[model samples]
Target: MAIRDWPEGERPREKLLTLGAAALSDAELLAIFLRVGVKGRSAVDLARDLLSSFGGLRQLLEADRQRFCAEHGLGEAKFVQLQATLELSRRHLGSLLERDAALTSPTLVRRFLSAQLRHLDHEAFAALFLDTQHRVIRFEILSEGTLDSASVYPREVARRALARNAGAVIFAHNHPSGVAEPSDADRRITERLREALALFDIRVLDHFVIGDGEVISFAERGWL
Candidate 1:
């Protein structure tokens, strides 16, 4: 049956309005984005098929424009809409981080960084500059590199910290290897950055290594 023919309580849109977005299944959430279905399939069924084809919601969202547009029932417009929605979520998270002390919401910090970096095919290093009150001031990608490594310059990081007039910073980098374990090089780089920033009286709050399924924190492990 068409979604319009379904009981109001059972429909994705109605359920989202009556219950909450979190109460919906992954397929239902995606169905809302999809808006409509092709031929005889319901929107939920179409979303389920897309998720299966792409291996899941994350993979589907991360798909390249060409790849995504080529999918049945999806086109350039949907791809554009999806990309916009993803960016809006990122900005919303950043705004929330800017309102609170960075360390006070460690889980939110991890989630924001993970969403920003986990899908990258290469290594990238970013810094979140914070004010004296620990509210985020700026987030920037300091360096980008190949799959295995990225060359991070302590001097550049220090300069950016000074430029932002930041009092503290949280460092983050993604491991394309899908392993969150801190390598010796990772430790060494963090120390170099910490020392360089210390010269300007700036503090290194924490360093995070983002992986596919885990985010390893230096402070949590007592490495900082």
Candidate 2:
């Protein structure tokens, strides 16, 4: 049956309106995005099928243009819509970070950085430059390539920190491999950055290695 044929309270849109977006299931949320069904299936049914085919919402959202467009109910338009939505969420997180002091809001920092970095296909190194009070001065991508220890330059990091007049910094890098475990190379690089920044009397507050689901922090592990 079509979604309209369902009982109003049972329908995805109605349920969302009555309760809240948080109350909706993944399939229900996706059904709202889909908005219409094809041929014989209801929107919810198509959403369920897509979720199953793609393995979940995250996988579907992260899917590349060609792979996403190849899906039965989705196409380039939907892919574009999804990407725009994702970017908006990332920017929202960034705005939140901008409004708050970075050190006082560790969880928010992790969430913002995780959302920004987790979906990248290639490794990226970023810095959250902070003022003396630990308020964020600027967030910048210092380098982009295969994220290994050797690829990130300590001098470049120092230069950027100096350029921003940052009193301290929180470094972050993504592991495209989805493993949050900090490798020995990761530790070595963190130490090197700490030493380089130390010469200018700047502190290396933390180094976060962003992985699939978890962010590992050198400071949290007492490795800093």
Candidate 3:
């Protein structure tokens, strides 16, 4: 049946206007952009298929152009549209990172770190160096570890933090295993980071162990 043939109130486009986009299903939301579907399918069906194949919104957003284009009935024209839409959304979110805002709050710290380290497969230690006003001045990836701090360089981190004049630092690292718990080495490194940045008066506000869409805060646990 034509999409319009559905109960007028139940249709996505109509519902989006009347109730806002959040009221629609994921398939319905995608269909508005897709406009139509290929033979034997409607836009809703195609969107559901896409989400099913890709796992969900996160995986779909990260999917490569070739994979998206290769999907049944999806061609370069539609694939490019998809690509542009995804990139635009990503940039829009990234724009939220402010260079001079106070980040003394845990809510801001999670918002910044979660977006920065969402989909990595390996452990990456990064520093969000903030200015006096708490605005983000520099975001530096300090170390990449295979198993532990075997690869993280403390002296180098100190050097960069000093050079950047980072008034405060928020440390973030990822757990590829999807566990948000801090390991012994993680705590050790937090201690090391706490000591190293002290001479510069660079406060280590929090250390986050990010994994599987959740974040564990060392500060929140009274560890930092």
Q: Rate the local accuracy (lDDT) of all candidates.
A: 0.91, 0.91, 0.78
C-alpha root-mean-square deviation, candidate 3? 2.6
- Candidate 2 stretches greater than 4 Å from native: none
RMSD of each: 1.5, 1.2, 2.6
Compute the lDDT of residue 162 as modeled in candidate 2.
Answer: 94
lDDT of 3 by residue, 143-221 (tens): 8766365677678888888899888888899897888899998898788879888877888888888988789989889
Candidate 2 backbone clash number: 0
Clashing residue pairs in all predictions, respectively, total 0, 0, 5
Candidate 3: segments with Cα more than 4 A from true spot: 64-67, 75-87, 145-147
Q: Residue 6 of candidate 2: its Cα lDDT?
A: 87
Number of the candidate with higher TM-score, 2 or 3: 2
Preferred candidate (TM-score higher): 1 or 3: 1
Superposition error at 71 for model 2 (Å):
0.7
- Which residue window of length 10 is worst by lDDT in model 1? 146-155
* Cα-based TM-score, every candidate: 0.96, 0.96, 0.84
Q: Tell me the lDDT of model 3 at 79.
A: 74
